[model samples]
Target chain A: MAGTAMTPYAQLVGPVDVYVAPYGTAEPAIDAAVPSTWYKLGPTTGDQTIEHSGDLEVFRDNDHQAPVKVTRPEEDLMVTFTVVDMTYEKYARIINNVGRIATGTSGSANVKRLGFKRGATPTEYALLLRGSADSPYGLYPGQNYIPRCVQSGNPAPARGKATRAELECEFMTLEDDTQSSDDDKMGWGTVQIN
Target chain B: MPMIDPIAAILKLISDNTNVQAIVGDRVAGKHKFAQAGSVNAWKADQSCIVAKDDPGTTPDIDIGDHVGRVELRCYGATPAAARKIYNSLIELIRDLEGRTTANTSNGTALIYSLVMDASPFTTVDPDLSIDMVVGYARYRIHEYALEEYQ
Candidate 1:
């Protein structure tokens, strides 16, 4: 008996939750591990790229026909999302890298001061993205990357328009030798496809 | 056979429990109210309430063909004691139903397997508290045959 062909609807859904661990920490199996703490980012999109190099070789026996050989490449993962809330905690990674934050309290007055300074050392961080709700899928970077804030947009206020800020970030994915299991190193991070 | 909405059945089960109703009263307008997911914003202070939201669940079991899913039930109250009381009552009610296979027939959904509390309820201060309020979350895993598998 022949079975009817049905469209596979196992597509990944949105409203991804982002988790971060200190740089250089070995990534845990994201599918089975719940992040200690995570921030929900949404109305978002994800992008991935693979960098490859190829060489052309011509042999006398091949009669001037060049054979192209391609090598497996590097993977790049990037995500851009808007940050509606401008709280210091929401921008901790960027602030910690590019600025200073002072914390103190006196006489029922709590103070949190954020300021920019030069010569601050750039910090790297490991990132993981999990699908929201009942979707059992996630994406993680194999290794920590020095996050570069490629773009930071100022909040724009307008008549009949909502004011929000945007942050564009890029991470250079690198091979992690710390992972002992080949299964852990499969794909860009340990993504759960089920 | 007609299917039952799991959320509705669970809510009805809670509503029918005398112990839960004694503390939280009737659905939305009671000493303690019950709402689903994002509707907890309407809950008032001094009123104990439980908010249920769907959680990311694990994969289905291959042998029994049952899919286990989690529901995060957040109990909120003006005081820690009140929150704990409501959470305890709900926990006991859930425990009492362990091994029971029959659903509220009125809800028309048969229980495929028992519902179990995944872990002990933990308390925390409400992050969005205007007044001092305590919140506790209990995770429950419900087992049911996946309809997609049948399809």
Candidate 2:
């Protein structure tokens, strides 16, 4: 009998969906139940880094050594995306949470700072990268909280040159201790491979 | 009646080549390792390896009991040049096995009739940069017979 042949399928065919929710709260699914706060990222590019550590042992008689135990130490997801709207309120909110925000009012003669604060208690979000819906092939990072973000760079405007603002955000996956069962600790954030 | 397992004999012959072993190791977890059909997805990016029996064709021969069939050798590589090198190495080894005989415990004996480069090697770049693959196919004919019974 002939061997089973693998059919070609598109693995990266859809736009990515980003969902935001308060920390220690229930996460929303990527389907029709997406929350209003969920925002689709503008064009983005990045990858996830899964770090692992291993212990090796060697014997006096054996010439080769092999790892005895391997463990995953950390997983970091980083992505860079262009800010779609400069005047959007979500931009201000994100900046307020991660950067310093200042507000001041000038009367007839002088102006003074009314309030200023640095972002604290970052919110968690889910990033869903969809493959073909017909097949199980997608990447979902469940309950990823942004640790840090920075503007890419400031470029001077010139003739025939276009400038687009971009932000590079780094995310770390956290275990959902709120879940009642240990099986749901990661909360379905994984690579979908059939 | 005793017969030689053609698949085992072919795999053994390919594994015995030192040059091939140096390029693609004998173990599956090696950087470049030999594989069977439908297992190419497991190979790492830019890895080079050989796959056997991907395509086979059998036909009847009046002179001999049966002309087993044409076995295909698929060579994969990260780059066109790397793939061509592996393909050439396989062709050289197959040519050396011409007119040779090998036996298997399950099967009796088999004679290698000839080796032919059925198709030229060609390169195809995968849109997914992770899986760029180059494939080449070769066909060989073998004659098999059961061991004769002594009265």
Q: What's the lDDT for all of these models?
A: 0.46, 0.44
TM-score of 1: 0.40
The true-versus-predicted C-alpha distance at residue B125 of model 2, in Å, is 35
Runs in model 2 with CA error above 4 Å? A1-4, A29-33, A37-64, A73-82, A96-121, A124-161, A181-184, A190-194, B1-151
Q: Residue-wise lDDT of candidate 2 within A114-183, one digit each (tens)?
A: 2223235444544433221323232222223232222222212123457455443333455556667765
Question: For residues B1-151, could you state the per-residue lDDT of candidate 1 as single tens digits?
Answer: 3444454456666767899888767642222332334675455566776666556654544543233456566666778888788778877887565222333534354342345567666778766553333333333323232223224
- Looking at candidate 1 chain A, the ten consecutive residues that score lowest on lDDT are A1-10
* Predicted model with the maximum DockQ: 1
lDDT of 1 at A184: 43
Q: How well is candidate 2 docked (DockQ)?
A: 0.01
**What are the runs in model 1 whose C-alpha is more than 4 Å off?**
A1-9, A29-67, A72-75, A95-99, A104-110, A117-120, A132-161, A181-187, A191-194, B1-151
